[model samples]
Structure formats: C-alpha cells, structure tokens
Target: MSEGFGAKVPADVERPDRVLAGLTARQVAILAATAATVYGQWWVIGRVVPLIVFAVLAGPLVVAGIALAVGRRDGVAVFDLARAALAFRMRARRLHTRPPGTGPAAPGWARERAHYSRYPCGRTGQLRLPPHAITDTPHHPAPLACLDLGTSGVAVIAAASTVNFSMRTDTEQYALIGCFARLLHAQTGPVQILIRTHQIDLRPALAELADSLGRLPHPTLRAAATAHHRWLSELATDTTLLTHQVLLVLREPTHLHTTQPGFTGAVGSGRRVAAVTRLAQRLDDARRTLAGAEITLTPLSPEQAHAVLATCADPTRDPTHGWTHSWEHTP
Candidate 1:
C-alpha cells in the first residue's frame, strides 16, 4: 500500500463525512427532524399544558434527539442500534423447518379462542421459515460446489489451508504479505474470506486405532499403540480441542458475461455456463495466487457446500465436522 498510496492512507473511507458542527449528514438530519417534531408538538400541546409540564414532556424528546445525534455504541450510531433492536424484537424467535404448504394451524374446535398473544404452536411448534434455504430447483450447469443465489449472483466456495505466519522470518513474512496483497489486488469481483472455528472431533481417529489393533505384527507394538490411544482418549476427555476452517468465497454475477439481461435473470444454460466459467477462472487464479503464500485451495463438492450452509443456518442442530446430508448418496 505504501508503494501505491504513499506512507499513509485513511482506513475509514466508508465513514460518513462531518458536514456541520462535528455532525455527519445523518446526525444533522436526525437532529433537525427531532427539532421540527418537538416544535410541532409544542404548537399542539404547549398551550393546553403548564410551562413546567410542557418542559417535562419535551425534555425527553430533546435528550433522545441529542443522544441519537451524538451517541455511538461499539462504533455504531445509536439510531442504527435502535432500529436494529426494533427489527430483532419484531422477527420470529422460533423457526420451524418443514416442506412447503405444510404449516400447521389451530384445530376447528379451538379456532375462536386460539388467536391471541402468542404462546407456542400447539402442533408444529414454530412459525414459518423466512425463505427457502437453498433452491436447487434452479437449474445450475456448474457441477462444482457453487450456489445459484438467484438475481444476487452465483457463489463458489473453496476450503483454504492456513500458513504458519508467526513461525516465518521477517523476510519470509514480507514476501507472504506481498503475495497476499497481490491476491487482493488481482480480484476483479467480490472475494470473501470466511473463518469458522469448531470443536475438533476424534471419533474417526479412535475408530481407526481400534481397527488397527488386531493387525499389529507384535504384542509389544500392539500394546504400545493401545496405551497411546488410551492416553489420547483421556486427553480428549479432559481438554476441549478446537480446529478452524478457512474458506475463500468467489462470486460471479449472472449478468457479467451474458448479452441478454433477461437471460441473466432466468439463469439460462448460456448464463449458467458463463457464470461457471468466470467462477472457475477466478477460483483457479486465487488458488495460484494463494499458493505463493503457502496456502492451498480445495474446491468443495456441492454436497459439502450445502452442508456448510445448513450448519451455518442452524449450528446447534448439527456438528460441524463430518457433516452428512440426506442428499448425499448412501455409498
């Protein structure tokens, strides 16, 4: 960055510029709107009430306006925080997963008394889901682990290997950073790096050890292996082992290479072909670029990508490791 933008460049380029009296445009607007609202309120209610009473009513409004204008929580404006809070409060808390046109309803006998301040769905036990989690219904030409996020775009995900940055020397670190920078600069479309951490699973390792127990050549070797396995089991019981996965997400808009705008929206065969080609090319470029920094990229199969999304949507319902879905072939 120093080579391109000189020694220093402002990091918070997205931060709104202060327009008047140390207030951003949003803050200024909010304050002005509040002032207008308070003046209108006084025009209607001030004459009916005493001076002290009117001040009492307007004091909270003034304080709220000032707080909205100047206050920030965790670097987010107070007004935004309040809006988000309102949205959160309004959204359904319990969500049910079921096929379409299967939402349960109150019985005919209890229909009159059923509709009130909600408790719980007596039959199905949750409200309808917000939207379809994945629409594999849409024809996708790419056989890779990519999703057709209709209208939004197509996204391809690759699991990325990590490098031991702390172990590298200063010279190696600088070179690695350069490689990383090159990868970032080379991106023509959106590239997202997602890091997810989960509890390490040791069941498969233990099962493998058990299977190998009888195949050992000597009793001494078998006994040693048994002891090591036992020790590992004990260690696992005592410690919480953690593992993290790094995923590189590459996106290609449907309309990028397609001529007809409606074709992109429909995600026709040609549009799908274009999206797939672009995504594959980008993924290949990223793999080669990241390899310079000692990072390997492994493209995920469609099943694995879907599993990852399902896990993300409802983490508590399934374990992250060794995810298996009904869509996968039994074999």
Candidate 2:
C-alpha cells in the first residue's frame, strides 16, 4: 500500500519516520551529537593524550553513543531508559506519609539526639509526590470524590455496568456498536473506560452463608446452603475467584491557569461547583445514552471512591465501606 492509502489507525502514532539507514531523525541526531563531541574533544587535546588511552576512552564512548542511538529497553529508547534510571537513583528513596510542615515538632533534646535520621531526605526535605502536586490538603488527601488534576483539570470516577455483547447476534452487536459510537460522538470532554479484575475472598462469603443457613425455611434448603458454604470454604482454601468491574472516568480541562487566555474569565471558588455539576451532567448523559446498550453508570460517592482507590492501590487488602480517609486540619 502507498504511504497515504492506509485506512487502519497506526499503533505507534508518535513514531518518527526513519530518514536515513533505518535510523529515525532523533537517533541520527544522537549519533551525530556524540560523534561531534568526541571529535571536538580529540581535536582540542589529542596531542597530549597517549594513543592507546584515547582509543580506550573514545571506544567506550562511541559504543555507548551507538547503543543509546539504536538500542531499546522495554520499548523505550536506551537514552530514555538511562535518563529514567538516573532520575530514579537521584530521587528520595523513602516517602513520609505526612506532608511538609505539620504535626507537633520534636523537642529540642530529641531533635539534637536524632540529628541524623535513617532516611533524612524523606523527612527533612519535601519530595514531590502524587496528591501533593495536585490539590493541597496541605498535601494530605481530603474526602474528595473527584481529584483536581491541576493543569490537567478535574477528574471523577464512576462505577459502570457492562453489557454481554458476546451473547448478542450480529445485528444486535452492530446496533450496540452504533449506540456506543453515538455515545463517543456525544462526548463534551475526555472519558476513559477501565476494567479491573479483583479476586473475591470467599471466606467472609462462606461465613455469611453459614450464618444464613439456619434461617432457611426448609431443612432441605438449609442442608443445601450448608453444602454450598462448605464448597465455598474449600474453594477459598484452594483457589481464587476473580470478578471484573468496569469503571468510567470522566475528565474536563478547566484551563484554570490565570495566565492562559481561556482563564481571562473568573475561575475562583465557584468554578469547582460548576466543574462538578458539569461532570455529573456528563455522567448522567452517558448513563442515558448507554441505556440502549444496557450499560449503567453510577457515580461513586466520596467514601466509595476512597474504598475503590484503596482497593486498587493494594488489591490484597479488603475494601472498607465505613472507613473515611480524612485529611481535615488538626489544629
């Protein structure tokens, strides 16, 4: 096929074209820059340096330049990988739960005694992390259902129900696809669909079943419930039962930066309310639009959102319904 004749969306849309010798412009630039620098160094000081010593130093540098230009690690260029590795090494090794400048200060004697902390960098200085870079609860997380993604704008998550498309006929599938396409076309802002699989802990379920066994109307029903509980108990002890959940994330860029031309209009405290209302309306519209496809979108409450985030952060831990992750000022 000719270059412009392709219909399918290319997988790597950001991929740069190879201009010379199967090397992209960026690769060629890296190689050229490395060669130029090496040659410049040789031209300036080559007379004083031993021939073998220059060869040894220049050989490794040239090899590294070639590697950086051509080699890839995990689909990332070696240059990028090295830069990331260096960045990782330079960053703080530990993180404190507390944000900078809060909580009671240590006593003078205690401060003197513990002048050097085990991971002083994590404690003494502020290392920028998530939730901190965004809204400041003074950097502590507040009970916000939606995250104010700062420059990227505000975002919210909704628990969405899925449709069993595989069971539908071709005609039904096409209809559903058309409905879905309409949903996509109607989008006023960016939207994301995330599917997460979680393992169910059947022990608690078995316990609940065990508790309900005696409440059964018939002895036969009670026996069957007891048997089912035993089976679940066995399964819990043996293997994991996984269930997939669909979540819808809606995002709208506030363009709230005062310097930006878009922000010439006022964007103060009232902006948050307007943004949230807009998000909710969008979610509702999504719910109504996807109704034809039998997909439901239920906006998660702040507590439920926390639980979902907590669960996603650490899947091994059980989700809490009643727990409130508070970050209110403690004066």
Candidate 3:
C-alpha cells in the first residue's frame, strides 16, 4: 500500500514495535561473532591444555552459551541472515530506511521523513539519492534497473509492453520475426536483454472500480460481474491462476552521430520530437517483430528511462534518444 526507500508494503498497517525490533538485529550479529570467537578460541586452546585447563575453558564456554540463549530471546535470532541481506543491499545500492509513525506520508522522501521517529531507515542512515540529485535523463531506466556496459557498450532497461502472439496473423508474425532479427543486428554492440516478470494483482484496481460501479444508478455491469465470478468459481474449484507482467530491457553501445553544431540555435524543438518519434517508431516496429518471436518489448517509463541513461550516460554531450543503442566512448 505504501512505498518507502525502495521498499514496498503490501498493506497500509504499521507496527512501530516491529521496526524497533530490528534495532536488536545488530545484537544477533554481535552475539554470533562473540560466540564464535570465544568458543572457538577456547576449543583450540583446550585441545592442548590439561584436564584442569580444559575445565577452566568450559566455564567460559558455558557463560558464552548462556549469553547466546539470552541473545536469541532478546531478538538476535535472525541476526546472521538479516545482517547478510543488509550487507548485500548496501553493495547493490538498493538499501533504504523508514522512520516510525502511523499516518500516511509522502511517497518517498516525505514518507521516509514520516517514519523517522519509528526506525532509522536507509542504509547508513542516509537516503540513496538526494532529492535534488535525482535528474531526468534521455532514456529513463527504472529506479531498480541497473546497466553495465563493457564490451557490449550500451544497455537500456525499462519496463516494456507485451503482446500475445496468439492474436497476430501469420504474415504479421513472420514479419515480426524478421523485424526482431533486424532489431537484434541493429544493436551497435553486444546487447544484454533482461525481462522482469511480475504478477498483476488487479484486486485493488477492481475493488476501486467496484466502488464506482456501486454508485451507478444501474447495477447491470456489477451484477453481471458477480454472476460471472460466481459461475467461474463454481466451475473451477480451488483453481489459482498467475498473471504475468513483463518488463523489457535492451542494453547496447552508446553512439553519437553527426548533428548541427552550436547550442540553442541548432535543432528546433519540433525536429527533436520528430527525431525521437522516428526512432521510437523504428524501435516499435522492431518490437512488433520481436513480439512475433515471443519476445516482449517494454520501454522504460519516463523516470525509469532517465535513470538507466543516467547510470551509463556521459555528461559531456547530450545523447540523442537513438544513442541508447549505440556505443559511446568511456573515459
């Protein structure tokens, strides 16, 4: 129901106590470390020590074991796994934090600010990207999308659109296949394509629609839907179906082409739109071909597109939309 610091909440409910419990997460880590060190050292030394010396070591071992037991009840139970996950998140740059509170907050930053009183959110107690630092770029990549262009040069990842092949004509499908091959060849360099598949749980959307339907003077559609659902449920007992949503990402080289020189006075805004549209059209055409081949092509949303471009983009010169598929010089 709410998103904060790159985290998602399936429900709007909040348990400040649950978050504060994480404060003890660090303790599990410390306890494990302490146990390993103390017990390990004792065992190592006891191997060579006399019976009396070993007995002495056993005393400390007993104390350490008791401490571990207390630590577990005190909230260090998931310490190892949680700490490792946190470390991985930091390395992947996916770390986020949330503060404590009950009221609804702003989407990201303001929401984070709202939760500040509850728990320390964000890794290292800092936001991943500063508010002003989030910028608009040419090919907006998803916030979660990352691009790595080495020998392949360019990589663009965004949410994509999916088309069902079962709906297309034979000729259209063949044309689509050819178009897809051409699109792949058109890549300026090695391209890494990643498709992220998720589920579309339209329950919330349908529920909202239901409220509007309820207000309708006519109950025809609502009644029909209810009947349909009832019949479907009766027909298929205990059946669960998965709805798959797809995101398409294309990674290639960043290339620059000849353009009119000088800033502001060079190309008019109309020309820029035309050019972007033209490129989009070509890409869309190719996407249709890929669709025939059962490949889903989803362009990144504006913000996500910008993020992807920003990650691999060079600031020296503006990259045209087409440049998303071309290679650029790496300094």
lDDT digits (tens) for residues 64-173 of candidate 3: 64454344433334434455777777763432233334235458977567567575453333222211111122452322222322222223344455555557777665
Q: Candidate 1: list runs displaced more than 4 Å.
A: 1-13, 42-53, 99-143, 199-241, 253-273, 313-331
User: Candidate 1 at 270: error in angstroms?
Assistant: 5.5
Per-residue lDDT of 1-331 in model 2, one digit per residue for the tens? Answer: 1244324777778888989999999899999999998998799777889888888879988999999999987788898899988888777765444666665676998776666757444324344322211221222123335655545666678787878887887778777888898989999999998999887757667778888887889999988888888777888778877999898888877666643222123554356546756876787788898888888777665566656666776687777542222222111
lDDT of all predictions: 0.72, 0.69, 0.46
List the lowest-lDDT window of 10 residues for candidate 3. 128-137
> How does model 3 score by TM-score?
0.33
Q: What is candidate 1's lDDT per residue for 175-229, written digit by digit as tens?
A: 8889999999999888899999766668779989989999999999999999989
Root-mean-square deviation of candidate 1: 6.6
- lDDT-based ranking: 1, 2, 3
* TM-score of each candidate structure, all chains considered together: 0.68, 0.64, 0.33
lDDT of 2 at 295: 81
Q: Pick the candidate with the highest lDDT.
A: 1
Better of 2 and 3 by lDDT: 2
**TM-score of model 2 (CA atoms):** 0.64
